[model samples]
Target: MDQYVEILHWNTQHGRKLDAAIAWLRKRAKAAGRMPAALMLNELQPGQGEHVGGELGLLHYPAPVDDGLDPADSRRRNLNAIFIDPDGPLVPDPEWVANWTGPWMPPATLPVNLRNPDGTLSSRQLYLACEHACYWHPGYRETTARFYTVLGKDGRLVHVDGDFNAWTVGRAPLTLANVADRAFAQNRSVLCGTALVADDIADRLMTAGGFVYVHGHAAEYLGIEGADAPTTDHGPDKERQLIPEEDQPERGLSAIDRTYTTAELIPAVIDANVITDPDVDALADHKPRYTRYGYPDLVAITNLPVELVHH
Candidate 1:
């Protein structure tokens, strides 16, 4: 029942550290009655400071001969994979998670929704009002900035980074129009954070016969526990009694006090593609997997395929 095993190498000795780690993992895998399907070695790169590691090489253990080795034995081949530690400097941050307040700078304008004088879309609106309602954690700001840029460029649609905020924004008459435009461009599949948003977006888009890629919360959809979830700071008004309950569950709900940013969303986009690589699609679509799983603490990662159940 040992489905997957990952080994992280951090020896500054470079090649030697990698070799040593692989050897150790091989022995461990053998004892566990498991054969490595692939061995990926990630070593530190040059001048990446001491934190960075190199390429993550994958070593898959063939069946039978590679299985059932003693954990204490050094020659054991019971390994799912033998690779360097994932947490290295060269690894890029995931776009889905948002940015950490590192040395990176913030965006010039807060990408948000525009509003009219009546708190709705104006017949003659001048500038788009970016929704400054979502949560911007210290580290996740970088992600928010990037998301804003993408949304701004693709003005035809409203890229709702599915969290509570998207609903709040969608409820806005003006913002809803943009959402409708994008949804119509695609099917009724605006990438949503959760099925909740996905369904909601689909309904609204359907009103105008429109849709977009519904980006759901990978953590929830994929059953990834302990992972961080995106959030925002906006919510529906308590006194707005005209809206139907089924029409808008998020109306009464509040915005996420904290949320993920664009810096994080990028890597997520990659990882989702990699982990969900189906029918050997991963062979060509595994780069994001390498970058995302390169973190040291991440032992086993799963990229759930965007299946029908998820939708």
Candidate 2:
């Protein structure tokens, strides 16, 4: 039995090189009364343009020895032999397997509208809801905001919320009070009996005007506590002084400073009624203390009754 076979530099323009090669090998195997364990077809000239040819290969192994098995069943038994045969020297490398298998078929396109019959929310709307929740706060070294998506009965994305925390400079022990105080200092004003941080988020959502609030404890929602104090970089005062002042919101400001700026714009977030407690239990049931990637963290307290059409 030949352990290996090679078909080198065959021109593809001569037509169906693989079929021709296989046919030639089958005739050789029939003449020899045994099949080659592996076949290596190298430098095949798939002639079309100015480009050169590529390589192609194939491998097959004989089935396990069994006196009871009929000789006619040998090919069928050996169909996957190359991959499983321990004694076979020719192993199917990933590239060789992939080439043999050909390219994967593309997945079918999903329906354009992935909304429930009630038409309350579309798939796109649900995705945006998650994004809005995550994007509300900008990333900072001292603060971390992590959001999670909530699915409805239909397994579509429906709601999202986050676990947010920020470290602050303070003498008090790391209590919720300290965190709330820091949050308050950051956004300077309270609205509708909620903390300044909560008010800021509420305001942004209200102005956009689509999502309905079921229940939100703005204090707890925007609360931060028990975080380590931010370390000060003790660079030279002269070098620090040389840094010019810039109006960019993310630059040269503490979390508190940014929150205070949001407070100044509190009037923009009108309609405090937009923040309501319709299904408190649902909110509590869905809200999560922590979430891993791809899981819902919060309750479906918020609903978007209409789809947004972007211009």
Candidate 3:
């Protein structure tokens, strides 16, 4: 998606290639009688160019994203949310913005938005941020941020971006040392800590329903499979009822594995929201370690109905 969007942004054709690709995608989905776009888009160059999202009938962040800075400026990196589809909420986050060297610039950071035009908190969720700019960089290592979720007036928290404390969060040690945790520890740098920070943020910005519908992958890691099959109860199971057995897997997980700077984020997001532990209940209790998060059950993605289960 980033590649396609990038082409749309920089290519002389602009908007043309992305439109073509979206057309192809919609065509395929229509032919199969499946949802056309379960999309999560990011790195979307902020602007109203073509508004492909609107054309495809996807819900968007609907806030002004321009930070009023040069596109080359790092502070304005995520000022705009390119796209936000419940199914495709995940976006690719290139640690190396444009300077993609293994480590070209240390402190590779940017800021995020905290409010909307109506003054309602603009942050729909936390996966949209990283620790304050003080933490990113070309030097990938394993230390967490002093302010894990965000950095504001009092330096209360540290996250990808935000200017104020939209809400309050407690301070606690997150030495879980999970997979991404270990990688950052070994390398002395890891974005996985962002998970903990985002976990905390999602607690405030989201509800159980937000988690229920957010089944899309970080990038194109669509959570489609018999295990992850969309569990819509009433309407119709497009992937199953309309599509054939052979084509079902395609609707499930794509052969393209390395979801890149993305795939890791999906599970990270799950870890933030759901209780992966195969014991206890999600809707009944929160993951003991996390507060104000999780659900009654952590069943396969396909097991739940396609309705929003608001918290």
User: How many pairs of residues collide in each model?
Assistant: 87, 9, 27
Against the true structure, whose TM-score is highest? Answer: 3
Instruction: Give the Cα-based TM-score of candidate 1 against the true structure.
Output: 0.20
lDDT of 1 by residue, 1-311 (tens): 12222212111222334344435445644684542322232222222222112322321111112224353432121111122222211111122222222222211121111222233321211111111212213223334434444433311222222222233234322222234244332222233463212223322332232222222233345444322222221134322222334544343422221122222222233222112323222122111121122222111111212222211
lDDT, model 1: 0.25
Ranking of candidates on lDDT, top first:
3, 1, 2
* Model with the higher TM-score, candidate 2 or 3: 3
Better of 1 and 2 by lDDT: 1
Model 2 poorest 10 in a row by lDDT: 102-111
- Candidate 3 is scored at a TM of 0.28
Q: Rate residue 195 of model 3 by lDDT.
A: 41
